[model samples]
Structures are given as C-alpha cells and as structure tokens.
Target: MELVFCLLFGGPSMVGALLELSKNSKDHVATSTAFTFFRLLEPHVYFLYSQYRFDKGDIGRLFIAGLGSSMLLGIIVGSLADKQV
Candidate 1:
C-alpha cells in the first residue's frame, strides 16, 4: 500500500519538483546542498533506526522519537537557513 501510494503520488510529485528545480537559476546550489545534507544525515538516521529494538514492543516509542527528532531537525535547519538568508 505504501509503495503503491508513493508510486502513484509521491513519485510523480518528486519527479516534477526535481525537473522544476533543475531548470531554476540556482539549480546546482540547491541540488548540491540537498544532496550534501541528505548524504550526511542518511547514515546517522539509518544507524539509529537499525539500532532501535522494534521487537521489544517499543515500536510506538521509537516511531514517536523518530518523528520528534525529525521535527526538531527541520525546525533547527529552517531557523538556521532563515538566519543565513
């Protein structure tokens, strides 16, 4: 179900956004910044998720922790970006 939804909706939207970003003046900077940020964070996120003991019946707590962490990261990054701009 998730894969199907992503294929039908998220896939196209992401493709469209990428295409639009590519044509923009700051495409290189925007793409490189995004790629760099994801590259830096992806490993840490994967490590954290892999280390989490889902079988211990803490799946809900893990999910909430992940969600909160992501939200906090977004807020911090957004504020930093705003300050830089």
Candidate 2:
C-alpha cells in the first residue's frame, strides 16, 4: 500500500523535477500544480475504494494506471520542450 503511494507520488515529483530543470521559472508553478493534482489523485481515489475492502489487485491496477498516465504526460511534455528548443 505504502509502496503504491510512494510510486504514484514520487514518480511524478521526479518528472516534475526534470520538467522544472528544463522549463523557465515562470512555467514551473503551473506545471507543478498540474502534475500534482492529476498524479496524486488517482491512488487516493483507489485508497478510498480500498476502504470498502476492494481486492489488493484493484488498488495495484489503479497505481499502474496512474503511473502510466504520468509517464505519457512526461513524454508529451518532453516532446513539446524539444520542439520549443
């Protein structure tokens, strides 16, 4: 459970950190907020369902989905940055 939370949150933060390094200061706040809101919310929604005793695999699936979404978003951002530069 904790590992799920860590991955969902940590992976995005690492992505955000990389984005921050690449983007100008003016863009960091918007980018960070956008990442945090979407990335962290998924596991939490799964956690709420788990409170009702949903199977562990269901929660794992949610974590995986969130991680995949973040990775896709990161790729899009990277590609856009490449275009900009």
Candidate 3:
C-alpha cells in the first residue's frame, strides 16, 4: 500500500522536477535554490503527515495549504522580478 502511494506520487514528482531543472538549465542559482527548497520542504511535509497519522482531512488541508503557499510565492516572486526590471 505504501509502495503504491509512493509510485503514484513519486513518478510524477520525479518527472516534474526533471522538467523544471531542464527548463532552468541556463540558471544555476535558480536550479540550486529550487532543489534546496524542495529538499527542505518535502521532509517537513512528510513529517507533518506522519505526525498526524495520515488522516484524510489532514491530507486535504495540506493539499490546500500547499496550493495557497505556491500561489502566494508566485505572486511575490513575480512582483519582485517586476521591480528588479
């Protein structure tokens, strides 16, 4: 069951990460920063799920929170980039 869950999420995650890295190949700093951020974020998320006993409600909350955070980060970064230019 855990293996099934891993395959379901891990495959897409690996592909997505590869594509992102490929897209940023010309920017070493961006690539490294992204990798480092994800490396730190993944463990914290996993720990939160494990601590919560992997409840369905908690998972849903986590998903929503992830989306919100990503959206907020995108907005902040876009604004910063605009300011820089």
Query: Who is ahead in TM-score, 1 or 2?
Result: 2
Sliding window of 10 residues with minimal summed lDDT for model 2:
24-33
* Candidate 1 lDDT tens digits, 1-85: 9999999999999999989867856554445777788879866755676687444346557667888999999999999999999
Candidate 2 residues lying further than 4 Å off, grouped into runs, are 1-47
Query: Compared with the true structure, what per-residue lDDT tens digits does model 3 show for residues 1-85?
Result: 9999989999899998998778754665545777889879967887788787997687878888999999999999999999999
Query: What TM-score does model 1 achieve against the real structure?
Result: 0.34
lDDT of each: 0.78, 0.87, 0.85
RMSD of 2: 10.9
Q: Candidate 2's residue-wise lDDT over 1-85, tens digit each?
A: 9999989999999998897789876764456777889989977887798898988897788778889999999999999999999
Off by over 4 Å in 1: 1-53
For model 3, the stretches where C-alpha displacement exceeds 4 angstroms are: 1-52
TM match of model 3 to true structure: 0.38
Report the number of backbone clashes for model 3: 0
